[model samples]
Target: MRGTVWVASDIHLGEAVPQTARAFYDFLGRARREAGTLILCGDLFDAWIGDDHALRRPPRWLATALDELRATAGALPLWLARGNRDFLMGRALADALGARLLEAPAVLDTDAGPILLAHGDEFCTDDLAYQRFRRIVHTPWIQRIFLALPLGARRAIAARARARSRQARRSKPMAIMDVNPAAVAQALRAAGCDTLIHGHTHRPAVHALELDGRAARRYVLPDWEFDHDAPPRGGWIEIDAAGIRLEQL
Candidate 1:
């Protein structure tokens, strides 16, 4: 094909150390020219809640920056998956952007093959508590209620939720944040896909595995970082006719 399909995830926009806005906008400029479709794995925002298009609240230069991408990416397909953080993205924003919001375990056809895309949280078979919570929260009834809450209320709830999540993460082992190998195999087999793309663990790499009767490849996208106490190890995923490439800013 003549275009590239950009895949990136875990932008985590709310962090204070440094923002990925600059890198993200820079990538958008290049991706618009080369990518026919852009798949955002998940966690596009650091802390997002409510369905209203409150993106006007983006930090001073951020909103204007993103508008440039909208202009350049006109009519290009942008498929976005929701992470634990941005689960609030709803129809209104998708309609405005002319993009599609994909749920977890999304199956897609790419120049590469029939591929599976997900946030990868559901495949963490080891995290029993989180899996249970995810089941309840992702249910249609709970999601509807959450989306219907006033924006301010949703924001407040998200704040508390985030705090608790941080505490839990501290108490849990590192392995709990990663994908389960057996679960990965099972999921790919069910989707009948030979490739999977996901972002959640923040450990970016390309992995190969034999699942079902076929071999499968998994690409783990990375989170963006910036110049702070921690050097900017910012990362992203990109695929073009030349092949797939990943760069750390």
Candidate 2:
């Protein structure tokens, strides 16, 4: 953290999005060359049933992704955080790439300053249904049961849940899909940090706020979509002793 730290999130890599996979690999290469420490905030994969799938019988795409990740980790300090979609990403995946698993809402004392980092889904408190689903899936016993099932079974269940979630999202209001202001305030207070960085909503921006007569800032990371999107958006946050900046890819 003495040098420049790079952060990005929501790449959503999978077999279907080969373009995105390639773009991410290229980004990893750039990070390896440029960053002192690289942190993937979350959603690096579209769906990660378990690390066993990658370890036991990785498909060609997964194999390539892992290779790129391993190469990057070998060059620089790499950290992976779990997102809602890839919450199953665990020690197995981290160990494979020689990367450390980052706990959400991780506070970092960096060259720029102390900052709070997370996947950003937990702040969507306005989405009650999604919150409930998150709570259910996040329960240790529930996750244990799910992980105990065969990989095929787990994949099928995850697919169905994702489908249902997409369908439900279609009917939900846009406001409900975004983070709650009160939740943000509470998180800032709880973390005792003025600067926060996270990604999940896909709406990227920087915000200024006042908490307890102190200035605060929140940086929302952008999602990467290269296959279907017209422009193929992607970006990362760079932090140095000078300050934090959002850099487009």
TM-score of each: 0.87, 0.98
Against the true structure, what is every candidate's RMSD? 2.6, 0.8
Tens-digit lDDT string for candidate 2 (45-96) = 9998988889998999999999999999999999999999999899989998
> How would you encode candidate 1's per-residue C-alpha lDDT over 1-249 as one tens digit per residue?
235677888877654633567677667777677668877777877776754635546555546544654565475777768888887777666666667777777786656556788888878889998888888887999988887887778878888988899899999999987899989988888898878878888888899888766777988888887735276666776666455666666
The CA lDDT of each predicted structure is 0.74, 0.92
Tell me the spans in candidate 1 whose CA falls farther than 4 Å from its real position. 15-18, 53-62, 65-69, 227-229, 240-243
Model 2 residue 49 lDDT score: 90
Which residue pairs clash within candidate 2? none
**What would the TM-score be for candidate 1 when compared with the true structure?**
0.87
